[model samples]
Target: MTEKTYPKVGGRSAKITLVLLVIVYIFNFVDRQILSVLAEDIKADLN
Candidate 1:
């Protein structure tokens, strides 16, 4: 049988990845909120 090794958690790469994910999530949330707030105005303009 062979043993498989996995990368360590909380490493530098992991921290960087986590930070990037959080940033993307924040931007996505803001974008959705803005669209929701302006939906009515956008619809009225388009119609």
Candidate 2:
């Protein structure tokens, strides 16, 4: 087992993960909004 005095995180993986999550959230919101807008049309067509 090797013990390190200090840990390095030059990769900034956390930042990358946050950015991707934000992007996916935005996409989900846009998709949900579009579906909501079309709800009236769908209801009318069903009857």
Candidate 3:
């Protein structure tokens, strides 16, 4: 019989992935905030 082993979760690749995810989340948050702040202005302009 043979056994297989897997690498741990907190490796370099995992850290890089986490950092990228955080950056994406930050951008998403900023985009939503900007939209919320300009919602009334946008609606007014459209109408």
For residue 3, model 1's alpha carbon misses the true position, in angstroms, by 18
Cα lDDT for residue 20, candidate 2: 93
The TM-scores of all predictions, comma-separated, are 0.77, 0.63, 0.74
- Arranged by TM-score with the best first, the candidates are 1, 3, 2
Which parts of model 2 are misplaced by more than 4 Å? 1-11
lDDT of 2: 0.92
In model 1, residue pairs whose N, Cα or C atoms come closer than 3 Å (at least 3 residues apart or on different chains), thus clashing, are none
Mind giving the per-residue lDDT tens digits that candidate 3 earns over 1-47?
Answer: 89999877688898999999999999999999999999999999999
Full-model lDDT for every candidate: 0.96, 0.92, 0.96
The lDDT of model 3 is 0.96
> Which runs of model 1 end up more than 4 angstroms from their true locations?
1-8
Model 1, poorest ten-residue lDDT window? 6-15
Task: Give model 2's TM-score versus the native structure.
Answer: 0.63
The per-prediction CA RMSD against the true structure, in angstroms, equals 3.8, 4.2, 3.2
Candidate 2 worst ten-residue window by lDDT: 3-12
| Span of 10 residues, lowest total lDDT, candidate 3 | 5-14
